[model samples]
Target: MIGVLVTFTQTDKFDRSTLAKIAGELRGPFEGMAGLRFKSFMLDEDGVQARNFYMWDDDEKGRSFFTEELVDKVTGIYGVPPKIEYLDIVGFVDNSGT
Candidate 1:
């Protein structure tokens, strides 16, 4: 598995409500996306940042998703470029059914 951390700094440009609205609007497309195990949209209003975490089935799919075009597109969306980091998943626990 692969973990992707995408951080959008300079989030002070948009208010929390606006950021939340954007996240809400963008959520539908990712539902049931192939190779995606999980995704979360997070906001740090106090820190002026928005971070999104993604868990994918493999590194290749995760890496392929975050292309230069995606960067540009998200830059336009959030009014700033994102800092993307990829990490290997050593272990995972899912207790959704519990």
Candidate 2:
């Protein structure tokens, strides 16, 4: 598995409510997305940052999803470019079925 962390540090231009609205609008595309195991949108209002965490079943698929064009599009939406990091998922626990 692969973990992708996308951080946006332009919270000065967008408040928590705005970020929440953006997340709500964008959440649908990720639902049932191929190769995606899980996704979360996060907010750090006090620290002035917004972040998205994605877990993908395949590293290639996760890495390929974040293209330059996608970065540019997200930059336009958040009013700043994001810092994206890809990580190896050593282990995880899921109890949603329970």
Best by lDDT: 2
Off by over 4 Å in 2: 11-13, 45-47
Look at candidate 2 and give me any clashing residue pairs.
none
Scored by lDDT, model 1 comes in at 0.89
In model 2, the worst 10-residue window by lDDT is 10-19
In model 2, what is the error at residue 84, expressed in angstroms? 0.4
Per-residue lDDT of candidate 2, residues 1-98 (tens digit) = 99999999863555878888998999999999999999998987475888899999999999999999999999999888999999999999999999
- The estimated TM-scores of all candidates read 0.92, 0.93
Best by TM-score: 2
- The local distance difference test score of each candidate is 0.89, 0.91
